[model samples]
Target chain A: MSQAPSDIDDLIDLMARLPGLGPRSARRAVLRLIQKRGKLMQPLAQAMQGVADTARECLQCGNIGSDDLCKICASEKRANGEICVVEDVADLWAMERAGVFGGRYHVLGGTLSALDAIGPEDLRIPALVRRVTEEGINEVILALNATVDGQTTAHYIADELAERCAVTSLAQGVPIGGELDYLDDGTITAALKARKGF
Target chain B: MSQAPSDIDDLIDLMARLPGLGPRSARRAVLRLIQKRGKLMQPLAQAMQGVADTARECLQCGNIGSDDLCKICASEKRANGEICVVEDVADLWAMERAGVFGGRYHVLGGTLSALDAIGPEDLRIPALVRRVTEEGINEVILALNATVDGQTTAHYIADELAERCAVTSLAQGVPIGGELDYLDDGTITAALKARKGF
Candidate 1:
């Protein structure tokens, strides 16, 4: 095979490391980047550089932002005496996109996992505990995933803040516009158990 | 939704422009980059910048490189009286990966497509014809794709260089390790017509 220029190959390797991309997709992306170097590639590089230089983890909420405090944590309007706990920044972003949550957030970075040897100390649990009191938080809402580790982490956090604040979790039920026939057995059971008046 | 830092949004928009990536995947990719800013994101940004500053299309073959002539075009050993014609640089790279061809290449950049109004002049067809006599080529091999536009471009090129030299095309048949049942009808017909002695 002819030698692909080293820089181009390096870019492809780095791109392949991204979450949803593999070697084949990385190659395709690189080819497109090269073709549109002037319009897209250059702008993408500049954007990446700008983000790299400015992006930082929020000290209070563990959210990603340019400043020490994420915009949500800095906003007085969002601090409605509630703090929503999530697994990662991605989940935090998902909640923000829903536009339903008016409270501040505490990103755990990851859920507690015994199999992976991850514990509360390994995450931002200590910071979250401090934030509850420092920010005068009234309720701690666990918006964790419906996974074993996510539940374990939520239970642990609930116990930690049992006396300090009101602890709650998101209601488990059928998603909006979802079909019962296509739903998983676990989800169907949850939906049945959590059934309410129509 | 809380405002994602504008730079972060910009990066995500650029990543979504890549061939295989969508908005969700781009968000995930950007999140990963933010988390690993020092390790992966910085290097990727630098690599992209490097390529953006240096990468240019090879004047002769229309292949991507950092110099005027691509390595394949500059190499004396590859000037073996044969030129493989491919529809794009990605296809040229695929052929190189197989390591079966031992000659130079002519990248058309794209196939002739009437619907897209992509004509031979829009690609490197004129340059390819010019190379035929200028470089003392013996045969022009068409390795264009199996698409309608690909075949149409191949026929057009063959006719253009018909009297100048021998024009051949890649043999169409079942792919290696491919199952007959899974093969398309066109491929099955082509394979039967081009059946060889085992």
Candidate 2:
């Protein structure tokens, strides 16, 4: 018996690689998309193509945008001499949804993972340092996750910018080993408001 | 302050429309793609495009495939005089993952809906009746969800196909209001094996 064409199989294969989706789920998702091609799949395809054509990383703060500088990085109002350093864009978005921090953000990409051999250079640490001096940033708030690697990265960044700017971290609302993406908007708002010096 | 670029906003807006995704999660997902443009985003874009270019519904069974007929429908070994009818591809996949049913599947795309004004003509019910008579099918197993709409559709199909073939419906394992997608493999297997005549 003949199988599905190679392209459909390829699509299912790629979808299987997504987090929380297995081969079975991938097949079902592909089938649903095919069934709703005009409404769901076509638009999804157009969006993906558009993103592929224009997507790029923000040079100043490691955020993702269509240009070299993301909207937050380019905004004059966001350049309030304060930068919130986060482990990932998800964390940055969590903070944004809370609507408490008017300052710009720096996405570190990931934590300092010794076991995985991910160092400061592998993240956006150097870019953060450059932004601190070049943009005349006065405060750097560390919003890394509460994991071991997250804390290590936070401490490293604090020590690196010790003399140049006031270094701080989000306070008590963040739980132990918590990722910012999982935090409620209220908790994030409280944490940002009660941020303390590292 | 200026907002995110139009294209980026469009992509995020489209992503937000997906099941279980909101504007905040959409933004986070989009941002992650932009950050890992080379490794993750590019491949995802290509996959989506490939599927869009090649995907089509199986002419006979309404299953998504790259060809006129899906693999299950095309397979001679699968045409064992029995066709397992399901409300959705998710239900079909649940049956496949359980690996107990040897017969092929006919995906109905959706159940009958009065509130939505959906009827037999809107679903694959006519095509299913055609398949039973044309393909010499002996049995049709209804593996639909245990919802009011699902049972209603099942009864409708059974009434329509009463003369041509023996119609059976999956038994007790599926909880009320539970979708087949949420059921465990073992439960689906047991339910399929112990299916009762309708």
Which digits, one per residue and each the tens of the lDDT, describe model 2 over residues A76-127?
9988999999987667767876789999999888888889999989998998
What DockQ results do all the predictions give, each relative to the true complex? Answer: 0.73, 0.33
Per-prediction TM-score, please?
Answer: 0.97, 0.75
Highest DockQ among the candidates is held by which one?
Answer: 1
Classified by CAPRI criteria, candidate 2 counts as: acceptable
Per-residue lDDT for B1-198 in model 2, tens only?
114567877877876665545676667667766766777777877887777777777898877677898888888999899899987766765677677888878889899999999999899899999999999999999988877899899999999999999999877677778899989897798779877899
Chain A of candidate 2 gets a TM-score of: 0.84
lDDT of each residue in B124-175, candidate 1, tens digit only:
8999999999999999999999898899999999999999999999999999
- Expressed as tens digits, the lDDT of each residue in A60-98 for candidate 1 is 889899999988889889979999999998898889889
Give candidates' CA RMSD values in order.
1.3, 6.6
Name the top TM-score candidate.
1
